[model samples]
Target: MYTFDSFKEVIASSNKTDWDKLKQVMTIIQTVQESKDQALYDYSETFDNVKLDTLEVMQTDLESAYHDIEDDLRAALELAYKNIWDYQQSIKISDGEASELYQKVHPLNRVGVYVPGGTAPLVSTVLMTAVLAKVAGVSEIVVTTPPQQNGVNQAILAACHIAKVDRVFQVGGAQAIAALAYGTETVPAVDKIAGPGNQYVALAKKMVYGDVGIDSIAGPSEIVIVADDTTRADFVAYDLLAQAEHDVLARTFLISESKEKIEEIQRKVNELAGEQPRAAIIKTSLRDHHYSVHTVDKAETIDCVNFIAGEHVSIQTKDASSYIDQINTAGALFIGDCSPEAIGDYIAGPSHVLPTGGTARFSSGLTVNDFLRTNSIIALKKESFKNMAPGGMRLALEESLQAHHDSLACRMEENK
Candidate 1:
């Protein structure tokens, strides 16, 4: 594990490989744009090692997957769906009304959700993204994922059925993003795309931002556990390892003022990591990105946490809830010892798809708001138009937009 005396040194040491990957993703997207639907099949053979006859998953297959999933798994998906749907419903934007100005919120006509399925099937992601889109009343919710040797995972299909996704495509990587953005013979174009995946998919989303909306260019999973002498070493260790197991590039940080407590947490992390099923990944990630920082006080610790701007932050100190307001940047915050970061990933009311790699400073997690667009409404009576037109005409004339000024003048005259 690496030790940092200051958060500045940690930021300096961080490695960035997005630009290199962006070049490769751009090449793949260009190929997809040229080949259209054929590129998806070619990528499947090259990356997934499968020859596909059809690009879309049929409705019958989704029904079979629903039945094939075990009873307990179905129950779990239903529960997650309920929580996400309920939370999204409660947060719907209220229609604004006033004498001269109002606002209307409307769901996008279509949206595409990508679920990572190469090494592991991210079934939870299906619930986290699609359920919110459904609750937002999007007309169409299309899904895309990489296919396995046989096909897409049954659990993923079952989750799609439960989430009421309109369609599914057996495709992934930059090519899938291109298809969603530009449309093809089979995959209809979508207004926006949401979900997380590897570097390639992230770069693809970044590349296609203007053509279609995206949630965020999500980076590797990360977590920062802020604890002190009162914190439980075992809990801190396991949570760190849980984040580390996400990928070989995942990062975990421990911030505290007590040297002995840091050492104890590090020791527990080493011992518990060996017992995890993804021990190899956990070990590599820990050696590469893990950091332990010793701070002078709570203020310094909070500063370190804000600088890291981790995707998930778990505060395990005394009165953890009190620290929530102090944190200025983080994708998600878990207060108190009883709330584990893993719970937020799986069953929490908030969507698990969050900004990463210090992007929490500007971006936010996925929500029903992502699926809806707001439009400003303007309606003015003759008196209201007379009251407001001169100011607008003055601004338009100052900018030398003669057409804009003329249009406003013409309307005002007609009203008169």
Candidate 2:
């Protein structure tokens, strides 16, 4: 299905625009304030087709959901919770003490987590955010999601219950974000918000970013597989499908030098495509964004992979571990065929929520660190301040800030 375009051609085509939907979504966000809660309700009916009564989910409903869920599914969710806890528990940093140095680690007082609700209930995402925040020792953790026609999804409620979230709110989209950011009559303001959602939610997060803290304004899901002759073509095809099924705008790519390998994977993609339930979405996503490169050499293939810097990078080359050492970007790197991108999305310890749209170049995936902020704490004994005053005054005067120099000099004089 991939064309034999040169490197530049592939890059150019990848940057091509289909901005009609993006523009419309932005307009919806811009017009949100005119209606407020009513606007969110309208979008729920239009986009999610679910009408609402009370906007917040209750504990009674959550307990009922936990009890209604099958024991097997509950067990699996519990296992995932344990795995995430074990991984994130290791991220603890001892609260730094202040002596002479001016750096300190401080935990945020409260944090809010948003879980996607429309199309599918993303119960696993609840685990991803809550576990990481809890590990960071955030004092108050709250969860927000849209209500379904009947009520909040049982699985999502169940996940919140297991995580022991301090509060659960029935809210979504810009209104939910605005509530968390500004604090309305019912919802409380939070220090940070983290999760994944459709474009409206993304734009809303971008809008409310400065008012409150956020993990990132995440983009659509992405996966880039670096494969060679050693990789099984079936595995490659399935890995691409795993990310592509996430959204219509999701991007998936394969970088390899072997023509036979590319052809085999393409055939497998077609065969597998026929059997998937989300075939229509996956097919459109593949046709629009998926491709295979016939790189000149292995080094060239690695260079090509780095340029993409996808949210998820799967290394299935002959020496995948060695290649992993060479690459410096990507939200998360899957070492071998057994570590599929899908596993990381659910049961794997690391966060499935990651930076996207080439942001892995600087930003990182969600972790306990995202929920906490570091403060710089500094203090000096009276004698130390007296000794350091002359140098500090000299620098302040050198910069022409006489007020700064005078303040230190005056303090030193008073001590003397």
Candidate 3:
């Protein structure tokens, strides 16, 4: 049971809501900041409930981990790895080699990827982040994830093998970010850090952003569905619930012009929810932040969708692709009823780590783009500099920066 709202109210309230709690994570530092080994050990004891003397995962352990995993799950992980790797490789490019003009394109020498470890081993995440770094031509990629039980999950080790991570560490949470940013004895400092994690991990990355590059401080997952009369109630309900199951904080919304469709979908959702083992989570998420809106027409539905700026958006109406073209914001667009949100999560070939909490309005889903950095190349001949000097000086003069104007003025005099 969700409530409807006009776009204006939602926008205003979202802005006014307290974000201070979320901001605090960036400020909090792990107790192990001074010593990487101690930090890892402390977090291991604190979060994972295990104390370990060694932080680095040995290759022998990795090999044994492969045997530890079931064959079917291993096959599934391999399939996911191949799909993700194949897709990322297509986007990677070698720098425009030997250009006459000053040009340079290259991957960072080192990068770090963080994978969550706790409730479930996110084997797919290792494929998503590490594989992309390799495709982007990074020389070295390292993985940092918490230990589960006593050690890394077997699936996680196998994924690391698939991702070709140069090093693996059994550390997680804020301390992991700090170690990657500052460099522990076993973990070398990386130029950039990428991947998703819980609140503490997210906050740590936010805090260490200036010290090292990081992906977005992702918020809870969210999905918004724009369904028409042609939409199946079951399809709409299931798709919305996919993101909702991520966490209770995750949000889901459905906007339709037809009141009957909205009611029918709600009924279907209620019926299906009872069967879900995670039903309580879904129910609370829907009851709290989720929305079911009855718009006046398709125009209003589009407006509502844009305002929500959901991480995943599905259009179950006719001309779904055309509607996607019309929509300005959304992390990922699933057109038509057949392509549900579930496909995007595991095997869709697109990275499921998307912008969340309305960040899709400005940011984007994770991609090879996130793993690559572009440096602008610029050069000017003596004549070019002479020609541009007067304009540069005039702007600097307008801004009342005498030194800025003088640097160009002196350069022009030297050319003469």
Worst 10 residues of 2 by lDDT: 1-10
Candidate 2 clash figure, as a count: 1
Residue pairs clashing in model 1 are none
- Model 3: residue 233 alpha-carbon error in angstroms: 1.6
Candidate 2 residues 1-416, lDDT tens each? 34334654665555433366556555665555455556656666776568876566777877888889999989988889999999887876665766865666778898989898866689999999998888888899889898677778889999988887888987777667766776655667899989988766777788778879998888778998887888999999988887778888898888888888888998999999868888898999988877677787878877777777778989987688898777877899998878888899889898899988778888889988887788876688888889899999999999999999999999998999
- Among the numbered candidates, top TM-score falls to 1
- The C-alpha stretches of model 1 lying farther than 4 A from their native spots are 1-5, 13-15, 410-416
Ordered by lDDT, highest first, the candidates read: 1, 2, 3
Index of the highest-lDDT prediction: 1
Off by over 4 Å in 3: 1-30, 93-103, 393-416
Better of 1 and 2 by lDDT: 1
What's the TM-score of every candidate structure?
0.96, 0.91, 0.88
lDDT of 3 by residue, 1-416 (tens): 22346545664575332357445444335345565676678767876787887888987776777777899988887888788878877766555555334456677889999998876567788887887888778899989998767578888998887667889998888888888988877789999998888767877877789889987877677888888888899988887777677778777888888888989998998888868878888888877767787888777778788888888888888768878667888988988877888877777677888887778889987777676776756567888888889999999999999999999999999999
